[model samples]
Target: MKPIVTIAETTQPDGTVLALQEHDGRRFLLSDNVQIASPATKVSERELARIACAPFRPIRQPRIWVTGLALGELLEGLAESVPQKRATFYVAEPSDELADWHREFYPEGTFATDKRVFRVHGVDTGALNSLDSPLHGILLHADTAPLHPRGRGFFEDRRWLSVAYDTLQEGGLLAVASSRRVPKMDRNLENAGFEVAYHEIDAIPNARRPKTHHLWLARKGDYTSHAH
Candidate 1:
């Protein structure tokens, strides 16, 4: 059974009057001062799944890196999209509580017990520099600020793009979802030596009304442009 949730107006430490919500007895972090009663129907997981699996459709199977394993919803979607027996999956989460919650409440046939999957390094996504693996795809769902920022210099750091570039193999794809539209995100990926593509995806149901997300797909080395 789904848990009951409550919404309240609150202020952040930065003095932003954002809407706060609690779901399944846990508080969720959201942007745009918006709130919802249940997390079971949020845009986050849909955004993650679209960004993670949309690029490599023709490939027989692809190895994927899923950063920010919040609630394991993204991982579960990814497992369903890709052939579990043929694909390799890695999920990185920074919070133990989130991982534990996923293990307890999520569906029974989710990505939890898959042998081809590996869960590791519950640290910040920024520390992904140490990750050594040949990846066909990388999905960044932790924070969009590294791609688009309301604050200066928050997304301009080159190391994040560099790490993303270094992690992908030639013809590999990297997709990130931004809360707001960011033209600079395209330029940043290009500056990092990737041919970038951009798309806008519909937000999940019942969380925020008429909200859409910006998705950026950048490819390392050479690839045909699909997003003109």
Candidate 2:
């Protein structure tokens, strides 16, 4: 068998190491020692996207933003859930090389190909601003949970959460996935003015795994003071 090859590597400002590795024909994007994305996590990860995209099904040509491009499983799942030719997904991936690795290893394009996504390269997804049309849904399933060395505080930072809230259309959805439950993040989400629902998922459903996952699905209320 071939060794797991490191396709690209970069050190974050905080001295965190980000590497894209390939093993057994599968690519793994790692934030230090933690597993960010890989084939092993695909099923459960897709399940996360599935749960997030379900409520927004009635929206026509719903626009969605996915913060990370670690693996395209989330996008794949979003594709399955929305299944609309006109649905547009804006994928904000901070690392261009990592995105390249994804294209090289998993094939370029988002959600099965290039049909579903408008890939945003080299942008800090955390600082994303509102769009011309508010997003119908936003899925944040990046490398690590908030406060982790590699998380970049996607959920922990109130600024980011605020931006996420304002970036969404009324009644839009925001879903966050993490390896474990975060009480603080839950509170932060609430403070950011979302009516949140939390769900726990097996990392690999129907298959035993020591790791569990937490998917927080929050909806932006159409009215009644949840606005930022």
Candidate 3:
């Protein structure tokens, strides 16, 4: 068996170690010794993009916000799923080193040089409010979201979900995926004004035996105010 070799590494502001590594000619990323992304798991990322952009394909200038840049698979998935030339992708990644790793080690990666992608500071309310136009979709994955302080709140906090709701155009989608089911996720999204639809997809499409992943496609609905 081939051993995994570290190609490069960087320390985040919070002192966690992030590394780019390769094993048997395949590249992947690790955060604090835990694997976050690899070519082997790209099927789930592509599925995330496909489900998020499928409805908005007819819209010529759809704007999408993607949380995290791990190995650029989400952006690559978006490029393949959304063919509109005018579509834009806003990537929210708090770690400068992660972006740098993409550029330095994987220059050919889609998000590394894609003109349609604009890097944002984070996915907090302030960042969401700064957008000039409401987004058509927002793609999120539990393992790929930012690791900065308060970053995880975007997944569970009603207040933050409300901000996301307000940031989207009517009927826009917020697609979130996780390796395992999250209790009360549907209620949390509903509390934020989304019409939630749950789906289970093959994480590793087409294997002798397949494992399913949990995905929630929450679409924004009619105008309403909900207490946070």
Best by TM-score: 3
The runs of at least 3 residues in candidate 3 whose Cα sits more than 4 Å from the true structure, single-residue gaps closed, are 148-153, 222-228
Best by lDDT: 3
Residue pair clashes in candidate 3: none
Q: Which ranges in model 2 have alpha carbons more than 4 Å from their true place?
A: 10-17, 108-112, 122-127, 142-151, 222-228
lDDT of 1 by residue, 1-228 (tens): 776453444443445454445656776544454322125323655665656576665566577877655445566667766764777787764444445555655536354577767766542335555567567877765342211224432235576667767777787777776556766788888899888877876666554566676777778875444311
User: Can you write out model 2's per-residue Cα lDDT over 61-99, one digit (the tens) per residue?
Assistant: 878887676767787788788877788888776666666
lDDT of 3 by residue, 57-168 (tens): 7778889999888888888999888888888999998888888878888788777777888999777888889899888889988766765365453779777788899998
Candidate achieving higher lDDT, 1 or 3:
3
Instruction: Supply candidate 3's per-residue lDDT for 163.
Output: 88
Instruction: Sort by lDDT, best first.
Output: 3, 2, 1
Candidate 3 to truth, TM: 0.92
lDDT of each: 0.59, 0.72, 0.83
